[model samples]
Target: MLPHCIGVYACGMGGAGMALATDATKIASNPALGGRLGNELSVSLGWMHPDRTMDAQGPTPPGFPFPFANTASGEQTSQIENYPDGALAFNYRLSPTLAVGAAMVPGGGGETKYAMSRTATGQMGFGNAGAMYDSQVRIRYASLTPTVAWTPSAKASYGASVILGYMDFKSNMAVMNPAFTGLPSSPTLMTSGANELERVYGIGLKVGGVWDLSPQVSVAATASTGTRYQRLDDYRDLFTGPLHLPPNFGVGVTFRASPSTDIVADVQYQMWEAVEAIGGEQPAQGGFGWENQPIFALGVQHRLSDRFAVRAGWNYGPSPIPDDVVFANALFPAVIEHHFTAGATYAISDRWEVSGSAYFAPKVTQTDPGTGDMFSQFGGGTVITMKQYGGQVGLRWKF
Candidate 1:
């Protein structure tokens, strides 16, 4: 579900822009549009206010086999005060129908820190999430991309980009002291020294094309190859060899409803089931168990005058994490499914422009069924709720 999460115009369009022709600033969406851009550059800043809450409620089964407390209730929440995802982009035309561009932008990332655990349960069980005491995980990702687009005819254009990606991670989690799990004698049953650090270097690519079917209708598609991140050689104990950014593809259409209004719709699919660190089979034992996700978005733009315009959009996607893996996803919850956005653009002069947007994702909550292996594996019924508020502003110029 992490498909191009930040862009000023795309954010106002519910993140749907595979077919919409935009100015030079909309770098995060379809790169194929570079060929149609004005010879200009822009810088943008975005803010995300994400609120994540985890709650546990359930009963310990009769033969649970642990001498911990009978039943438990716990809650943990996270708010990222300084989570800023920003970008810089420039586009220049080499010929009437050929253009090139470059951008530095946020890839995808998450971070959370908390210190709370159960009294007797320790931290290593499938129930360990209930004991999220002394737990922390962080990811920082960015990409530098150089892109080129070719317009063969006035109605068709093709584009591609080279993605230079970088990511770093650090994690510290608590686990049940091996001694408490029938290994040997120890005074404290909960041990909290499992620390892991890693960084990755990777490269990937994106290719796309737009076809204008008529004077008022157009279609576009984009495909992104997966980026295989190098293993955390320093923390082999925590991760296996390959961690990857799964491949994704998107298609969209733009309809010129009126001389002054436009409509856009797009669909995107993420191959989450293809990644190991993110998607695997045995979450009960240790798989991430994330499912493939498809996202849909629709937007409309209306021009009130020559120098003023407004936009509104809506977006939706299914949850990637099944309740089965809710226990394992406490650190990186990507459960949001709905977004509503609004934006405006103003031209101050023939060459100066300003733009801004706001979006909100209402609370979405998932509760695990505490029965059979689900209950025994999770050991506690886990409920997770996630919500977000975001805003972006930018300045642009024309040559």
Candidate 2:
């Protein structure tokens, strides 16, 4: 079974105060907000679901070196109908200048399905060619952060926080083919599973200033640096080889568009070069060579009345997987381009609130036709495509 742990949400306008300063949530954003806390506590919960689809195609040439070869064309389709996820976070104020919090979020995960059947014609006698592959993955992470901030002056503040967490991942793969009944065909049937949990620990430091350019406008900036993590061995099998988690950084701006509305924009960088697989121990075979990536997000919040608010956001990043790693398993294609989100918050009472958000990632599909030595062995060629979708809901309580 896939891990049921939901991933964490980035620090966005829908959360607490610092959420207005930056959109980077996987890590701590504004520690100074902790200093403003009264003796109250806040708790939140959220849910998400992602759908995915894939397709592949190619041609089988006559007299090919492999079984099931004959000048014929073939195609395959695979999809993960529905995937579910959830998360929770809690924060409490220790004192006027100190706060502590914990959160659980989805780190990374995917699911896939593949099914194909083809008939060939020519001297090759490629009567029927078919293959089926299915795989699914789930990753969950929980973090504890203790924050401290000092407001030396009303307009200047400095804060620090440490992130300590553990990541749990589970995955399953199954493949079947009828063409391999003869001599030694490719493993006509195969199945495998990996469930490993790892720990991640790091520290972050932030410094910022609020300069009053005038009564109507103010400018602020913050900077930070943190440590990397080493994942578990079972999770490593999903990658090409041994891998490490890299450190990351971010910056953002908040603009007061009106007395009751604000606009925020942020740029974040993730060190994915350290990741090796979907969910397994250290990378196993040839390295996939993923690199550090950047993510951009923009959000706006408007206060319509005293107890209601509206929000919308957008995020984008590049694909982390390379094209040449031909493993041909249908777990994760990693070809998403952008995420669009919209959410709202309503006050149920003076100390309770309810919120929900939806994120849509346009499906990214790719088809790779087998070629060279591999082409002659698998009949003719292979094609592959992928797509995805995600959504979430949450509740917050303050006391």
Give a tens-digit lDDT track for model 1, residues 1-399: 363345677777787777886666454467788877879877778888888876644554344554332224367776453588667888999998889998887777777764443322544333344433334567777888889989889899889888888888776643334344442332132223244556788888888898999999999999988666777665443443455777888899999999999999999888887887677554444346778888899998899999999989999998898876665565677899999999888999988778888899999988756442442254346677888888889877788
Q: Please tell me which predicted candidate would have the highest TM-score against the true structure.
A: 1
Superposed by TM-score, candidate 2 places the C-alpha of residue 100 at a distance from the truth, in angstroms, of 2.6
- Relative to the true structure, candidate 2 has a C-alpha RMSD (angstroms) of 7.3
Error of 2 at 34 (Å): 3.1
Candidate 1: list runs displaced more than 4 Å.
Answer: 1-4, 25-27, 57-73, 79-81, 118-134, 174-197, 371-376
Q: How close to the true structure is residue 31 of candidate 1, measured as C-alpha lDDT? A: 77
Query: What C-alpha lDDT do the candidate models reach, one value each?
Result: 0.71, 0.45
- lDDT string, candidate 2, 1-399, tens digits: 111112222323322223242211222455554444443333334444444443323343344343332223233444345654555545565655445554444434444443332222212222214322223444444445555555455454455666554455454332233455543344233222322234444333444333334444444444544333454455443444333334555555567789878776666566655444322221123244344666666767777987887777676666554443222432455666576666677778877666656666676654433432332234323334444445555555666
What's the lDDT for candidate 2? 0.45
> What TM-score, to 2 decimals, does candidate 2 have?
0.67
Per-prediction TM-score: 0.88, 0.67
Q: Compute the lDDT for candidate 1.
A: 0.71
